[model samples]
Target chain A: MEEVKVYGAWGSPPSHRVEIALKLKGVKYEFIEEDLKNKSEELLKYNPVHKKIPVLVHNGRPIAESLVILEYIDEIWKQCPLLPTDPYDRAQTRFWAKFIAEKITPAVRDAMLIPGEDAEKKTEELIELLHILEKEIKEKKFVGGNRNKYMDIVSLYVIHWIPILQEYSSKHVLTREKFPGIYDWIDQVLLDCGDIMENLPDKNKMFDVLRVIFGPRNNYKPT
Target chain B: MEEVKVYGAWGSPPSHRVEIALKLKGVKYEFIEEDLKNKSEELLKYNPVHKKIPVLVHNGRPIAESLVILEYIDEIWKQCPLLPTDPYDRAQTRFWAKFIAEKITPAVRDAMLIPGEDAEKKTEELIELLHILEKEIKEKKFVGGNRNKYMDIVSLYVIHWIPILQEYSSKHVLTREKFPGIYDWIDQVLLDCGDIMENLPDKNKMFDVLRVIFGPRNNYKPT
Candidate 1:
């Protein structure tokens, strides 16, 4: 008997990444919704170093960091392979996934969440990065090549969350005219994979949460 | 026919990581030393995104980022496995490796390289992180049990380069008394594995370079 549980928040991108990966891998997991304001003790105990959500606990052993969790899920399940079989291809997939996590994710946070003098500057930096991504996209239907794979799953935030994020925030950087490649990629992912829509948080509910989070208190930064 | 080329700098820990992994795997390769001050066209061509070193060019195809390159090497050359074969164990290995790369490495760069108002704060953070790592070290002779594996290779900076960095910079956070676990682990790695010392940069040479780099130009931030 295998026990799997995912501790994550609805609106958090990193948390969402884990859920999508598991679902794609066809691994049945218990989703434990965590309140961002008041985190559960298990969450803290599991991930003491960062104390962040999106932890995948397998057989009571907790693995924190969505990227780590995603790789773990892929390795264990092995049904629908997330990474490509080829060594070089796998490296490329890992590379882009990491690029999104490290570079783009932080840019999203800085641009949308924080309100300060550097807002415009941060937004510009994000635009510059997205354009770089646009070039990488370069007519590829999915980040992982054809079907939705690990890189594609990792990039869910860019397409789904970023639009919602743009709605709440002052900056509107990811436009169709500017990032046509990204827009096309998003459409293909959504069109081809109907199952992806299942676990994704309700848009209006996300907006409601974002409205409060990024509402009058534009400076309200979530941990 | 297989041709492997590594573009890396002498003093860089990330660069050294690639060399160590290659040597461990018994893969014969050519080392192309890059003047990080004036990065080559090939380096930029290979890694346009970051344009940083420690890129592994297998045949003609180039793969950048030390961590990504490490995985590539492990997958291709199966003789000496960098990661454990089991899924859960591999996850553990990757988790620790990522922790070292993302968390500890940045803290080190910030604390030593950039002399600023937050130097003290950064040093404290590094110490806190190291202590946390000390707890993890426990009684493990090597990061990879009984061998110098991927995590051990990644953590080379923490033990080898950090002392030299401390000598160059004012902050001496890593000490024997304060971090006995780390110190013991370091001694164990060096004593047991002699090949690790082969590719490691000369201490005196590194000091000379660091002394000039961190000299009067305390604000000299390298790109």
Candidate 2:
């Protein structure tokens, strides 16, 4: 019997990424909800370097980082493949995934935390990034092709978390008209893919949690 | 006929990563050195998003970002596989590789750019990160098992570039005594692997170019 476990938080976008991937691959996994206010000892033990959530443990070994976990899941299960078979296509998918993870997500979060003119500047920067992504998605049905794949799975943060971020910040940059390509992708991944829709955390709960964490009164600085 | 072209710059550690991976795979390719000051139209055309070098053009399709390119090379060529065959081992390798690329490299660079008390603080932060890596490497002969592989290749930035950064900033943080495990692995990769040794950019040349770009007089902020 193969034992798989995910140590993650409910409101965390990265944690949701892990759950969605597992659900997509039809792999049975035990989800251990972690408290960001006071992280579990196992979370720290599994990921000593960063001490971040969404660490995937299979049998006994632990894998940290959502992107790394996604690849591991695809490799181990070898069914309902996330990544494309061709090397170039896989590279392109991985490229966009990395851009989404490293660039877009951070910019979105940064846009929220900052206030005033700087926030506007950051929002603009994010818009520029979204434009690049919009162009990429314009030519395809989804980032990962016909059906939701690795890139689409990686983009859950954009679909689910960005709205909460926008609501909190009150800077609506990701409007449907501005990013029609990405907007269509949003429907395809969230609505078309029942597996992903089933696995997502409640958005209002996420917004509420985020309010406590990054509310104007709190001097919240991301680590 | 498979045509592989690397658009890279000397003195750029990310660029070196692409070269090392290609050499390890015994993949024949042409190297196009880009002038970072005035980048070529081809480099911009190939990597429109970032407009950065170390873009791997395999059969006219370009892939930017060194880590992505390395994975592409490994997947396509498959000789003397850079990543391990076991799924868990591959995940561990990838986890560390991402840590190195995203966390370690940026910290190292940030440490160089900042000055005074901040630089010292950044240096300490970098040392803390190195300690984490040291613990991981203490048990291994190389990051990539017995032979120099993907993790080892990814760590070229730490082995080669940190020294330049330290020299430029005048902060000696990565001494052999401070990080013995990493030091030993560095020798194993640089000294033992003739391919890597032969392919390295001239260190002094790199120093000169970097000095022109980031010297004290120049208000050089990395984009």
Best by lDDT: 1
Model 2: residue B146 alpha-carbon error in angstroms: 4.8
What is the DockQ score of candidate 2, to 2 decimals? 0.84
For model 2, residues A38-152, the per-residue Cα lDDT tens digits are 9999999988888999999999778899998999999988888998888878888888888988899889877875555687788789999999889878864433464437877
Q: Pick the DockQ winner.
A: 2
The DockQ values of the predictions, listed in order, are: 0.77, 0.84
Q: Which pairs of residues collide in candidate 2?
A: none
TM-score of chain B of each: 0.90, 0.88
TM-score of chain A of each: 0.90, 0.89
lDDT, candidate 2, B1-223, per-residue tens: 9999999987787898898888877888999999888999999888888999889998888999888898889899978898888887788888888888888888888787555568778778888998888888885443336443787788778887887677666677898988888888888778767667576766667666767767642433332
lDDT score for residue B62 of model 1: 87
Q: How accurate is candidate 1 locally (lDDT)?
A: 0.82
Which segments of model 1 are wrong by more than 4 Å?
Answer: A139-148, A217-223, B139-148, B216-223
Angstrom error of the Cα, residue A37, model 2: value is 1.1
lDDT, candidate 1, at B74: 93
Q: Model 2: what TM-score? A: 0.92
